[model samples]
Target: MTAHYTSQTDTDRAATETATAPAQRDRQARGIGSIDRLAGRRILVTGGAGFIGSNFARWLAPHAHVTILDDFRSGSRDNINDIDDISVIDGDIRDAGLVANAVRDQDVVVHMAAMAGVQRTLDNPVDTLEVNVEGTRTVLEAAVEASVDRVLFTSTSEMYGDLFEPPYREDGPIAPKTNYAVAKAVNERYVKSYCEAAGIPYTILRYFNVYGPNQDGSTDGYVVPKFVRRALADDSIPVYGSGEQTRDFTYIDDALDATIRSLGPAGRNETFNVGTGYECSIRRLAEFAADVVGRGHIIHTEDPRPYRVERRCADITKARGVLGYAPRTPLPDGIAKVAAAMKRSDRQRAREV
Candidate 1:
C-alpha cells in the first residue's frame, strides 16, 4: 500500500494519483479545443467570489466576459480583486434591483450564492430559505428580465441527505436533513420551476464533495480541508461519528469543467451529478492529510451528530452521458495539491509573523 493510500489496497491504481495539476492547467490554458465556446459572451455569475464561484471566475475569465456579483457575504476579494478584465460588482443577490443590474445584458447567469455550510444552515434556517430559495428566485427572475439565454443552478448532494445507497441520482426524492440542504433543494426546485414555466433555460448541478485549493475550509463543513488545516496545525484530526461516513469526493477542476459544460448548447435544464464517484470515509481522508504533513498521529473520532450520518456517493451517469464529465484528478493527487497550497499559505502567514 502507498504511504498516502490506506492499508486496504485496491487493484485500480486507476484512481487519479500521479496526474500533474499545472500540466492540466497548461493544457486548458492553451485551449481545450471546445472550452472557448462561451468566449466573448457576457456571463454573470452570482457568488463568483466564493470558493466554487471564484474557481469558476478564474476558469472562465480567459474564455468568457465574466461578470462577478458578490456582496462579500462569504466571498473573498482575493477571488476577483486581481481580474481587471472581469467586472466585479459588490452587491447582494437578495436585492432584486442589484440582481437585476448584475444579470443585465448577460448571455448566461450562474447562481451560486447562498448561506453556505451545514452548521450555519442549521443555526439559521430562515436565512438559508430566504437567501438560497428566495435569492435563486430573484436571480432567475433577473435572468428573464435581462433576456439571458440560459442559467445554471448550483445544488448539493446534501439535498440527498441520509441516502444509504451509493451513486445518488437526479430522480430521487428530496430528503434534506440540514437547513443548508433544504435551501439547496429549494434552489433546485425554483430553477426547475422557472425553466419549465417561464421557458427560461436552466441546468442544475448537484455537486458531491468538491475539494481544491481556493476552498475555505473554515467556511465549509467539508471533511478533507477541515482535516488538512487541523492536521497541518499539528492538532488532532477530529472525526465526528466514528469517521464511518463516506463521501464521493470530486476535484474542483472536474466540477468547474462540468459547470462550463452546462453552459454549452448540450447543457440546458439537464441536472447532472458532478463527482469522482470514489467513496472515501472521513477516517481515510484524515489519514491522507496527516500522512501528507508527515504527522505521527491517529484519527480522533467523536460522537456522530444526529443531523449528519450516512454516505454520499454520486451516480454520475447523467454527467457522463450529457456533459461528457469524467473526473481526471485522483483523490490522492487532489488532496496533495490542497496540502501543498495550505503549506504555502502557512509559510506566507509565518513570514508575516
Candidate 2:
C-alpha cells in the first residue's frame, strides 16, 4: 500500500506557536493544559479521515507525529488533504496486517473508526456489527501487541438509550436501543477487557451529539449538519416525532479538547461523558438552525424508527472534576458557526465550478 507523508516547516511551527501562545497560557493557568502532554509522541489515529477523527488529527499534527489509517469507506480524502505534516495510510482497521503495521512504534492509538449513523446501522445491521465490533477488536489487539502507552476509544451516548432520566452519568446503566449503539457498547466492553488483561492504559469517551464544521450534511448525517444544510438551501427543516426529543449538542472544539485532556494521567482507565450539561429539544434545534441561516421553515415529520431516545443530556460533572473539561459554546452560537461554515463551503464550491 502506498502512504502519503508531509512535514511542517520551521516557519509554520513558529507561526502556530505564536498564534496559540495566549490560549496555551490560559489553559495552563486553568490547569487544563494536560493536552500538552501529548507533544512529541507518535500517535496513530484510526479512521482519521472521518469528521471527528480528521479534526482531531489535524489539530494534533503540529504538536505530534500523527499517522492516519482509514479505508475511505465513509471518510473523505478532502478532510485530511489540507494538513501537511501527518502521514496517511489508506487501509481498513479490520485488516490485521494493516492495523499491526499502523500500530507499530506508536506511543498512542486513538481509535475513532466505526460504522456510524442510526439509520445507516439499522439498514445494515450485520455489516455494522462486524465492522464496529470486529474492527475495534483488531485495533485493540494490535495496540496491545505494539505495547502502546495508551489507547483512547471513542464511544457514543446513544448507548444510554431512553431507559433512564436525562443528564446521564458515567456510572449509570446503559440501555442501548439501536444497532450502532449496541456495537459501540460491546466495543466498550472489549476495550475494557482487552486493555485490563494486557495491563494497558485505556480511556473510553462517550460523546453526545458532536457537531460543527466539516460534519456530514447528507441525509444520513447528524441533526445539526442536516438541519444547517436544509436551512442554507431554504428548504423546510424536518422535526421528527413531536420534536420534543432532547439532546445535548456539544460543539466539535469542546469534544476535541476533552479527548486531548483524556490522554493525560487523570483519564487513565476511565470512562467520561463528553458533553455540555444543557439539553435542547429537537424543535428548538430546528428553530435555532432556521434563525441562524435566516431562512427555512420548520415542518413536523413522522419518525419511523421504533426505538428512539426521548432525552439525552450528559452530566459532565465527572468530566469537569476529572479532566477539567468545560464546554464554552452554547447551542445557538454553535449553530451559527455551522451555518457560516456551510455558506463558506457553498461559495468555495461555486467559485470552483
Candidate 3:
C-alpha cells in the first residue's frame, strides 16, 4: 500500500476547518497525522448510536459537527455517550419528514440505520423491507432533496447471498437468500437509481462481517458475538454446520477508516467492498475467539444458520485502487480487540456491585 501521507498545507487547512467547526476540528485534532479529511466536517450517521455508527461517531466527534439518528430499533444510547457534543435524533428511518429534517444542514450523510439482522428479518419480513428498502429510499431521496454533498450507502455483503463465488466483487449479481439480504439489495437499487436520476453522488459500501466493541444481541446467529457471549459465560461455543462455512470479518475501526475516506475525493456513483480479503470459517473463528479469551471447551452443534450454504469474502482491488484503502487490522488482532472489550464490559458490570 502507498504510504498514507498529507502535506503541511493539508494539516493547516484541516486545523483551520476544525477551529471554525468545533466537532469537525476535534476529529482532525484527534487523528492529527491520520485520517485528516474526515475531521472537522458536518456528518450525519443514521443509526449513529449503533455498533458501527457509534464507533464512527466516536472516531469523528469533537473534530466534526456530528449528528446521529437512531430509532432505537437495534441501537443503544450508551454506545455514543463518549461523544457528548454530537446531535442525537431519536427517530425512525422510515419517517420521511423526520429523516428530511435530519438530512437538512449536513455535509455528508452516512446512512447506517435499517431493519437489521437475519433473525429479525425472518421474524418480521415486512418491517425489514420497510426499513432496509424503503428507509434507504427515504434517505437517498432526502439527500437529493437536501442537496447534500455526498452520501455513503452502507450496503451489505448479504446482498450477494449464497453466491458460490469467492471474494465477491461489487458487480457480482445473485439472489439474496434471506429477507434481510433481499431488502438490502432493494435498498441498493433505490440508492443507485436516486444517484443516477437526481445527479446525487454516493458510495455503496458492501461491508463484510464487521465485528468489534459494543456489538450486542442485535444480530442473532452472528458468529462473533454469539461465540463471544458463550465464551464469556464459560459455555461451549456453538458450531453450525461442519464448521467450514467462511466469512471475511473486518474490524470496526478499519471499516470506519474506509468510511471516512469515502466522504472526500473517492469515486462517486460507485460501489466497493469493505472487507479484509482473508476468510475464516465460523467454527475456526469461534475457536480463535475462545483462545483469545483464554476459554474453550466448545461443543459442536448442527448448522442452525438460517441462510442457505455458501462461502463469502471480498475482492478489495477497487477499494485499494480508487479509495487508497485496505483492511489494515488483521483478523486475529481484531477478534482479540473485541475479546478485550468484552472483558472490560464484564469488569465494568462487576464494579456496579
Candidate 4:
C-alpha cells in the first residue's frame, strides 16, 4: 500500500477547485477517465470514522476533498486523526440540521451511518430501527436539498435473511429477519424513491460479510474480529449452534475497491451485490482464524444470537460486469493479515504494560 502524503498546498488547491462551478466540474468528470473521476471532488461520508467508513475515507482523501460527518457513537476520532487533508465534523445523522450543513457544497455523499450489528439489534430492536431508518432519511433529505451529483447508500446482505439460497443475486427474495436488516431494506426503498423523484443519481450496494483491521470484535460484536482476538489470546473460539452457518466474507480492500468504482458513472441508479462468490462455514471460519493465529481451541454451543443466517454467497456477476470488481484476497491470506495485526497490537500493549 503506497502512502498518500497531502500537504497544505494541495489542500488549498483542492478547496479552490471545489469552490468553482459545479457544472464545469461535472463536465470534466464525465469526460475524464474512470480512474480520475474522483479527483478533487468534495465528498461527504456519513459515519466516516467507523471501521469501513474510515478505510474508505482514507483511501479517497488523496484524490478527493473528504469531509466526515460522524456522531462519534460507534466511531472514534482516532480513526481519522492521522490522515491529512480530511475534515471531521462531530454530529449525528439524525440531526437534520447537522446533516444538511455537512451536505452543503459537496459533489457526492456516501451514507454509511446506521445502527449496525445483529446481536446489538436483537438487544434493542426499536432503537436500532429508529436510528438507522431515521438517520438514513435525514441523509437523503439533505442530499436532495444540496442536489449532490451522486449518492451511495450501503446496504447489507443480511437483508436476504437466511434464505438457504447459494450465491444470492441482486434481485433475490427479501426476507429481513433482524431489525438491522429491516432498517437497511427500508432505507434502500427510501433511497430509490427519493432519488427517482428528486432526479438525483444513486447507487445501492449490498455488502456481504466484511472483515478486516479496525473491526473491534470486543465492542463491535463482529464474528471474525471476536474469533481472531480470542484465538490470539489462546482462548477457546466460541461457535454458535452446530457451527454450520455460512457467509461470504469480502475482505475490506476488495470491498473498498468496489465502493470507489461505484462512485463513477457506471453505477448510477443501480443495485449490486458486492462480495466474493465463495461460502465458508462458521466452523471453518473459526478453524482458519485459529490456524492463522498459531494456537487456539474451538468450542461449540447453542446459538446465542437471534435470527442467524444459515447460508450466504453473493453472485457478483453484476459487480464484475458493471463496476469491474474482482475480489483478490483469499480467505487464508486475509485471515493471516488479521492475525498479524492482532499480534502487533498485542505486542504493543504488552510493551505499554
The candidate scoring highest on lDDT is 2
* Per-candidate TM-score against the hidden true structure: 0.90, 0.91, 0.87, 0.89
lDDT, candidate 2, 139-162, per-residue tens: 999999998999999999998998
> Alpha-carbon error at 200 in model 2, in Å?
0.9
Q: Score each candidate by Cα lDDT.
A: 0.76, 0.86, 0.75, 0.82
Model 4 off-target regions past 4 Å? Answer: 1-35
- Candidate 1 TM-score to native: 0.90
> In each prediction, how many residue pairs overlap at the backbone (N, C-alpha, C within less than 3 A)?
3, 0, 12, 0
Residue-level error in angstroms, candidate 1, position 247: 0.5
Query: Which lDDT tens digits does candidate 4 get at residues 106-171?
Result: 999999988777666788878898889998999999999999999999999988877546778898
Candidate 4 matches the true fold with a TM-score of 0.89
lDDT of candidate 3 over 1-353, digit per residue (tens): 11112222334433432342553343344324335665677889998888888988887775789999998877887887778789999998889999999999898898999877767778898888788888888888889998887788898888777655777777777667888887778877888788778777888898999987668732374668778777767778877667777788888767776776666666577888999887787777777767655566677777655555558888899888887776665665555556656666779999997
Ranking by TM-score: 2, 1, 4, 3
Where is the poorest 10-residue window by lDDT in model 3? 1-10
**Regarding TM-score, does 2 or 4 come out ahead?**
2
Error of 2 at 141 (Å): 0.9
